[model samples]
Target: MNKPWSESWFDAYAPERFEAFTPSHVWAVLGLIVCALLLWLTRGVIRSHKSVSEGIRWFLMAVLFLSEVTLNIWYVTQRIWDAQTSLPLELCSVTLLLSILMLFFRSRWLYPIILFAGIGGALQAVLTPNLAYAFPHYRFIHFFVAHSGIILAALYMTWIEGLKPTWKSVGGAMLFLNGLALIVWIVDTALGANYMFLAGKPSTPSILDVLGAYPAYILAEEVIALLFFSLMMLLFEVLPGGRLYARSGTYKKTY
Candidate 1:
């Protein structure tokens, strides 16, 4: 029997569950990385052509926005909309919303937060996704596409818009994350929800599995986040090659 259109599109319990390190997962990861590399490689061309750059930015914004909206619609359609888990309180979800704003406004203030926390959070979600559905499922495609869009938003601002993030931006991002986590914690307590995995580690096998148990892993995550954000600064801002690019005056400062 053929499933109804709604069931075909929004079924929450798809037969194939996402398995990390599977061929499909690996290909998706590599594909996103290639896109990022292509953007960097063609930065000059993109900068020279304003219309093309704007179009790409708008495209990313649309993808990110639609992915998020459709995921919520799926949740509601599947009758799985719980206040605890259905809300957009997860790290990547929050970053996805911010990424949209970052692209639209080209706000320098939002750049560092997205550059550090947005990329870091989204990258973790990409590597060890906590998803229920596998390839070709709406949730699976939505999960990866939304996370990838968050990553590309940061890259677009940096490689295309030339918005530079300073070392202090690392601390800024950490502080912002901590503040957001605090708010999420309060919400989790009130709703008995585990948004951001604050109540406990995720059910899936993730980096948190090796970190430690319960509250201890939360502390460990802070250290891990710091290290990752610092590495981003080194790679994107402090590297000698990137310094040369900055000195060349190819990047027009907009904000």
Candidate 2:
């Protein structure tokens, strides 16, 4: 039986019709690749033209901000808005807001946070989306756009704006994440929500599934996050451009 499009798009807690790693997943992966390539290819142009770069950055920020607003509105209109899951407490949700701040102010302090969180969290979300809707669905489109936009913003800052992360940034990000995790843990305990997946691994099969179980997996996630942050810092160090390397002094405002 053919399912109604409205049912698929608006239904809360809809069952997964398309399995993971299927054609839909393949298309999502391809879309990410295209987004990455487009951002990389435009790096030189962004570097050469400050006005164009600012315009692009602002546009991306606006899209992310507006998409989130629209998503909340959709949830409300559908009468599915609940404190448990509707709150913007998830890592990707928080990072989307951080990405907006980073673009709006070009603050160096927020750069590492966005880069680490965006690459580690947002990239993973893209690779293994925990979504129910399929292609052409509003939720599907919003999820990919939001996740891909985050990655693009991070790469744009690093490769185009010449922002680089330092060893200190690795420590800062680890500390910040631990603090945020603690807060999320408390919220999850209170609301029985799974923000940041700290409460439990997702129902969908994910990299988290192989990490172990429950409390043990939470510890594993902490270790993984630190390692991911370190690897990201190393990437910036080894990249070709001198500007990509971490400078040894205080951060000065670039914007």
Candidate 3:
């Protein structure tokens, strides 16, 4: 990113960089198209009345989880560190889709909080974009698409799968996200990549900033997670259909 000469966001980039459509732009577009196609196909699979085994659904989710992890590594860690920050773009879409599909087949227990985070965060992120405009590259496309996918997945899980949130579910979500945050922080230190912007060189303000300071952000997230999780449970639990059935239970969760 070029210095704005002033402090403004729009004047930061040179005209050519934004105007020029290069090979990378084309490749990124193609990648996004492929992801869209796959998501569309997965929706069809989910809608089909075929009864796939619970074990099979769990296994599919596991595969998606691992694949998304690997993609994140390649996309960020593999590249030279840049101050421009962004959410991990790799397999977020696949991860959200699989989470929904798995919740539909078997809520097990943790599905509802996942739905909450996926939906709530996506909704907020979409309405209030972090960047002023299409960034260094045209990353808005990927960011919008992937985050929106999470919302879609969460909606399907809640409305169609009837996933519900419990206290245990909320706790699990916090633990999992914080654990991942620690890992990303450590990895960013080692790899010299700002994967989670934990290195204190982020281009834009992160959720951590709004929540609080270093460790405080983690605690703040827990409190917010607890509160939001409760709201999500209330909303989904009272849906017209018995959507709560696809979840673990209709128990009300408290922090």
Q: Which candidate is the best by TM-score?
A: 1
RMSD, model 1, all Cα superposed?
A: 2.9
Backbone clash pairs for candidate 3 read 162-243
> What's the candidate order when arranged by decreasing TM-score?
1, 2, 3
Could you tell me the lDDT of residue 217 within candidate 3?
64
Q: What is the C-alpha lDDT of each candidate?
A: 0.86, 0.81, 0.50
RMSD of 3: 9.7
Residue 10 shift from truth in candidate 3, angstroms: 17
Candidate 2's residue-wise lDDT over 183-242, tens digit each? 998999999899989878887768898899888988898899988998877776677643
lDDT of 3 by residue, 62-81 (tens): 54454445445535654732
Error of 2 at 48 (Å): 1.7
The regions of model 1 sitting more than 4 angstroms off are 1-9, 241-255
Q: Name the TM-score of candidate 1.
A: 0.92
Question: Backbone clashes per model, in order?
Answer: 0, 0, 1
Provide the global lDDT of candidate 1 against the true structure. 0.86
Which candidate would rank higher by TM-score, 2 or 3? 2
Q: Tens digits of per-residue lDDT for model 1 on 131-197?
A: 8777777887888889999999998998889777766677889999999999999999999999999
